[model samples]
Target: MNHALQLPRLEKTIPLSVVPSRLAAANAAVARFLIQAGAVREGDIPQAWDDALQVCERALDAWVKRELGALHCFRPYFSLAAVDEAGGYPSASCKEPVRYHKVDICWGECREQQWAVGDALEALERQQAGCGAAVLDVLREKSRFVYPLFTPDLACDVVSYVYWCGEENEEVALDMECGDNEDEREAMREEMVTRKKLDESFPAWVIATPRKRRLSRRALARLAQDASDPLARDIAADVLALATLRIEDEFRPDVDGEYIGFGAVLSWREDDLTVRIYDDLLQMAHQSEFCDRMGELEIAIDAPQAMRGWQSAMRVRFKTIRLLDRLIDRLSAGN
Candidate 1:
């Protein structure tokens, strides 16, 4: 991977402070970069502001060409990022620069040939035209020109391009919205294809859990409709009930974008009395969101342990599974 770009002469002129938050740090860095580039003025007259924007646009155009190569090789697309209603970067008003720093870059026919955020460089390298390599090289060489300052690894990646395709244009609105469950995903896919005439897309890195394995509302509906045996349906419903609490394996950060949190799966056999819990459901239990639901379940009585050994964790998981099964049985029979 290439190292981050630095314009040494500009850096020498201005000292940038490291901010506590990633976004703030990036904003400060970009503002400093733009000021140095003469694309933005600290305090200036109205006519100078327009002139500065013209300079900024020229910079974006040149950088895009140098980094991405021929304009025809890429497609213009917009990404939606969830913002906190509370506070942070002030939301863009109609008249101001969109200041959208977080976005996805995709090439080809808008849908088919796009790279996921982190994977973009690798995909570009694969093109063999050296566009990807060139882009990374230029980016590293003149890093400040890009928005939402990020490492070569794409960590803390920010959108630096100020221009956007407006919402009125159907052709440019490439949505990356992923619904929580497979049904929702399918529904979104259908909407994209039939209604929007676009292919359903997702982040390249996310490994989607299989539809059958996920215990979602759609899974519950499938079990209720397809399972011939009453007990099987009840057990599946109970599992879905537990999993739908949407327990997260990671802690909630103060600021986040669109996310579909993790869910759980139960692996059981027809003859076996115990079921194996997959994924970090115990971690879910520890989260306050699930505390009340977990407190009511007898399985919560067992002390939650950080899974050190699979053998030991499996033993504990079996007990918890059995407890859940018994609870389901009683509830089903009206006990």
Candidate 2:
């Protein structure tokens, strides 16, 4: 990855006492952007702001764990505005030099991570390229654009935005939206074809779609059973069994809700299958197998907040179906 495109590492530390105020400012800016874009009603700002704050808090917690520090501040370098284009609803666009810094107090220094609007646009393009232009183009038309100020890892990071495209919608709706019934069907057909191709190419690959309900054991079993390849099937079954046992033994029932995070991947060669579960898609690129297969899988969750639960459960529901593509290539060559 280009150094400019990669997320910045922490370099300095900010005072903990200033975090709450900084977060408030960041929330206010996001709320303003959403309202101006006509994405949110004035009456909804209060509740939306509260929800945004919660998401920031959750993300901050994750950052703390990874960086061993707390959030320092959010420095806004650019602002989001609604731009009216010919023959369309006002679209949100970022002004030039559009960027923001997410500062965290790590190792006694106030380190800052920057995500520019350009970076977001580039990331979106990469996502569309990976997942299929048709699928994302349809989603983009109907969905509100949300630019994450920080590096997003889990579903919560994506869902933290205050505004959604539709009125009173809680999450980023993945349901294919089209003008007519025929168009909808055509879109679905195209998506199904794309999915089928992905499956045939990478038997272990899985795509995580938005879900409305909790995941059940039966659903997981079905997923395991759905794998046509012996190795893929075995890996799926093993992941299911291990995830179930871990949840049962290490934690109580997930009263919060279902597991609806981003995605997971299981990579194996020959007799040995390795299970690696992750919510961050960008980090997957660091893996040797995924390095060359750019745009093969969606890199970010573009919808609403996903339900919180066992991270492993997400693996069962939306398994990584493409990680083995390169591995298979190498095996064929006896490399």
Candidate 3:
């Protein structure tokens, strides 16, 4: 048996019926599993416990990042101010902020459901093949069916995120989008984004089945051909297997129609052992923490002659507060 359970979501520790998702498909799968299992509990998939509110808030923050993606939709069309200029294309004065352009794309809300955990498990063990087929149906259509229903006129919402979907959806992205800059001016982007200045480089990424995205035969040959560090490259290939799950989470398609998705919990079927590639980023962010915090720190060496130290500290503090304030504003707008 190919282990009827699909995705790495079925860890060796989990039952064959348990299907976890780090993509939109999985969210639908989770929902369908609950329905079939008769474990439907009326609530959110991101079901936050009273004690877990803080953790939920942090996780939500990390997951709701693509709201500005709609802003890019505006780029194919208007200026930031023009969207709010009262009479710009799509009549920027409308109340909804996310504008719909390019008839090919749209977004919608993810529904709330009660997952009956016990029932789902029973169904999985007993229903067998039926359970697998049910989950797949939910995965492909539930969200896409509702995507075109939302109004796209949020002028102010341009900079905000849509929290309804998983971080799915694959359109080519600029390598220069280092996740820090918010300005969308074309002229300035050219000046600020040249080919990477740092030696570090991220590959051009896509969201898809791991089998398709895994280090390819051609990629292996290329890695072998390049001699700088063959062992390191081999190691990198292994590390990338885990990293690909994170990438899939980032680019998974919108099942709920919203730009950002209800984050997924994913796993994989590696030979001999089943594994998960990505988990919640907030909990695991420390894995990516820099080895050298000292590299960026500066020594006063000789104190600046023209600078009044307290005023400079105050200015730095002022900018920090503003940054946080903008962030909070962005979060509130989405919810």
Show how many residue pairs clash in every candidate, following the order shown. 5, 17, 30
Question: Per-residue CA lDDT of candidate 1, range 45-81, in tens?
Answer: 2332222223433443343333333332123221112
lDDT of 2: 0.28
The local distance difference test score of each candidate is 0.29, 0.28, 0.24
Model 2, 1-335: lDDT tens digits are: 65666785643442222324444455444444333333343333333233343344344334223322222222112111211222222212423221222211111112222211222222322432222222122222211111111211122223323122332232232243543466665655454323233233221211233312223446446645774545434433443443343112222112232222211121222211111112223343344333211111111111112112222233322121112222122212222
Best by TM-score: 2
Worst 10 residues of 1 by lDDT: 292-301
Q: Write the per-residue lDDT of candidate 3 for residues 38-73, one digit (tens) a residue.
A: 223243334432222222223322222322232211
Candidate 1, lDDT over the whole model: 0.29
Better of 2 and 3 by lDDT: 2
In Å, residue 24's CA in model 2 sits off its true spot by 47
Candidate 3 positional error at 279, Å: 6.7
Candidate 1 matches the true fold with a TM-score of 0.17
